[model samples]
Target chain A: MDEVLLRAVVPTVIGVLVRRGAPFAAAEDAVQDALVEAVRTWSAHPPRDPQGWLVTVAWRRYLDAVRAEDSRRRREERVEAEPAPAPAGHRDDTLQLYFLCAHPSLTPASAVALTLRAVGGLSTRQIARAYLVPEATMAQRISRAKRTVAGVRFDQPGDVRTVLRVLYLVFNEGYSGDVDLAAEAIRLARQLAARVDDPEAAGLLALMLLHHARRAARTRPDRVLVPLAEQDRGRWDTAQIAEGVGILQAALARDRLGEYQAQAAIAALHADARTVEETDWVQVVEWYDELVRLTDSPVARLNRAVALGEADGPRAGLAALAQLDPALPRHAAVAAHLHERDGDLATAARLYAEAARAASTVPERDHLTRQAARLHAALRA
Target chain B: MAKYLLLKHYRGAPAPVNDVPMDRWTPDEIDAHMRYMRDFAARLEASGEYVDGQALAPEGTFVRYDGEGRPPVTDGPFPETKDLIAGWMVIDVDSYDRAVELAGELSAAPGAGGAPIHEWLELRPVLAEQRTATE
Candidate 1:
């Protein structure tokens, strides 16, 4: 049985229940129970109509839970007391599910957890494992998040940016455990893009694709990071890059110029190049400028400095970097690179070592350490 | 997800509650300990938490560059001063608490008299890739 296909229908089934006046948590729980049953029994009894089957099963399960809470009522009254079942409905509710799960009231982590379960149709255990939290902790977090959102009305639309932010967080989680959350984020983004005409959704999808395309070459065996300039570009997934570029082109045509589109455009510029030397640094610098203005983010400015260094020269890059706080993360690494380019190998080596000490990830630390080692070896020779 | 290293040390960590040397254990007790460890790893794999693990050989060599034109220099294996890392099991999990829980479980592997060892396994967080271009 195509579990993904079954999972894809989950939001709509829950939406049907919620529209029928069922509490969001109770309806979500019912749908999840139905999903578990589906996974177990679908191989033996595959339904001809998956959505219809799920809606029936989930609605029935919701009733069963309610009835079991107090079996004092006659079966006829139980059926009558229940809200009339809403129409089985089209796939349109998936977008609503996204908005509900990404509701502004929920914390980002809680929203992400809720979305992965209610919309992404992931098991609590799977989500917990993906995040590295113990199953019990994740369960409490998810249940708490659900309780918070239980009262929210689904009719009023939510801010699309909030939804995008949640999806972005999911994508940024990248890969760990068994699930590729990046891929899951892309899947949800694609679903959102299909339902909404918002260019930013396309922008987000484009950005995710562009980054995901280079995932294979991001690290070497044993998870040692290979910096962009040194990565073997042959490993990049061409198909994903093409798709991202296509989506980006359409978003750019809208002329909205959101932060995501700008980031995607920068990524596209890198992807279009045959090698690091071939990258259009000038155009990338322009996009970074656009991104900096849109978000006014320190992170964007930091990236802009790097691009500026490439577009202008190492000295110009250093000049741009000088405008920012030296305490910013990776500032030393960037400084080290620009210094090495400007013929200050001794200083570069020192900064590289410093950067290595502050490195956030194992691979990044190893990469910076290797850079320092090479520079030190050069000095020794 | 956060990745962590669970380091089993031959020395240096705080003394375990079960402080008896492995050599003191019966052969069957040692076998049971190994089996428990293997099963622990297997369970982590089935749960999608395992990344990798390895056991170090007892001996190791330290080398250094002498000069550009000279052969590299080698030093004596300092078994006395050195803190021997017996092995490491890497796991990717959601929270620091979860990592601690796993470490606690690993330390419970059977030891002398086939009772829980309570060995002090060092739990260290692994650094992660940058999510943004700037930070």
Candidate 2:
């Protein structure tokens, strides 16, 4: 079968197996087997009904495994006792899979893995590679997560916020493994937005598209981390930016303000600017204010301070920064940036060094270290 | 998804018995060794198989909390310890077999003289709770 058709059908097949009370792990295996068969068989002869074909093949695979482990009599009984086809026109069961995958019981990593497995129809190896973990370790984490949420009712709806959070995490990982998680996240988010009609999902999808659109300009061939203000605007993906803006406009039309919508608004403002100096920092700061109300996260507040600095002045940004906790991750980096903008090169250089020490990733540390080196060299000159 | 910790041990391995010191190796050999490690990391990144990898300082200071009214006591590099960890990589993989496969690849990371070490790197599965919830 074509890859796109398979991707669309696999989740529906998984939903059927899950509703049949197949354990998440077994259902996943069965679906994978069916997908393999589909790839092998369907390439030469496309199925008349792809979803039905997948469901039938997957059910048989599941029963084959179950039969192998059970007594002959029990196996025969199960095979003969297959439940009636799910009633037509019933609510789609895939949403429950989304909820179960996002079940609060599972940790974020587990939740993301489960979502990719069950909803995205990705294999354990594929998921493991995407997350840069060993296939075995990722497999165990996914299985454990499935067991944790095995009790979730099929009909129960899951928290939209939780599901969105998982998708956000997936998008933020940026492309690392064999797959582009950012694209996968967008695909999943589109599925979710269609299912739930949630504006925040749209908002988040828009935000991701907007950010991804700028990815080309975010780094140079030498692998340096270019801050947004310094990024080459010409390289930004205008198509993605336009799509994001369109989605944000629709979401904003709903008038139900959300954290994601506010953030998307800010991203949209940035995308609209022809040059960094032309950025509407005043409107961006206003949206940040809305975002701070929606999600009282310190990171949001810290970001708002940067916008405030751009809209108002460096002193105003510094004053806003003073109110936040000193130990927040990247606090020193933000301070360094603000001080550097304020022309306190000495303090900026010192904080840059401090930030470099606290940087969590090699690229981030390298960037900060470069800042410190540059400033220190300038001082010597 | 099982989690495996690939631990690098700085102990219980035969010391290099070659009469020539590492410094005597051709510059190209040393460059090859560094390239091997860099390539290994790049491969892991491409495969989306790396979780977290770090090189640890050989020297470690030990600190212990004291009784209720006292400050914690700090101790030294603990010369008595036999199995010191040089570094480690935590990988989340799909099965024990895949973990072994990756570990086998990691074991081939270049050592002195640009040769694959193939040394024993202990593989331990991290307990689930210890894993950070965030990616």
Best-fitting candidate, measured by DockQ?
1
Q: Per-residue lDDT for A136-197 in model 2, tens only? A: 66677777787788776767777999999999988876775577788888888888887887
Give candidate 2 regions above 4 Å deviation: A19-24, A72-81, A84-91, B1-135
lDDT of 2 at A24: 68
Residue-by-residue lDDT tens digits, candidate 1, A3-74: 677778888888888887778898899999999989888899898987888888888999888777646656
Residues B43-104, model 2: lDDT tens digits: 65544446778888879988999999999999888787887888888775556788899888
Model 1 clashing residue pairs (backbone): A131-B94, A132-B93, A132-B94, A132-B95, A133-B94, A361-B127, A361-B128, A362-B127
lDDT of 1: 0.86
How far out, in Å, is residue A340 in model 2? 1.1
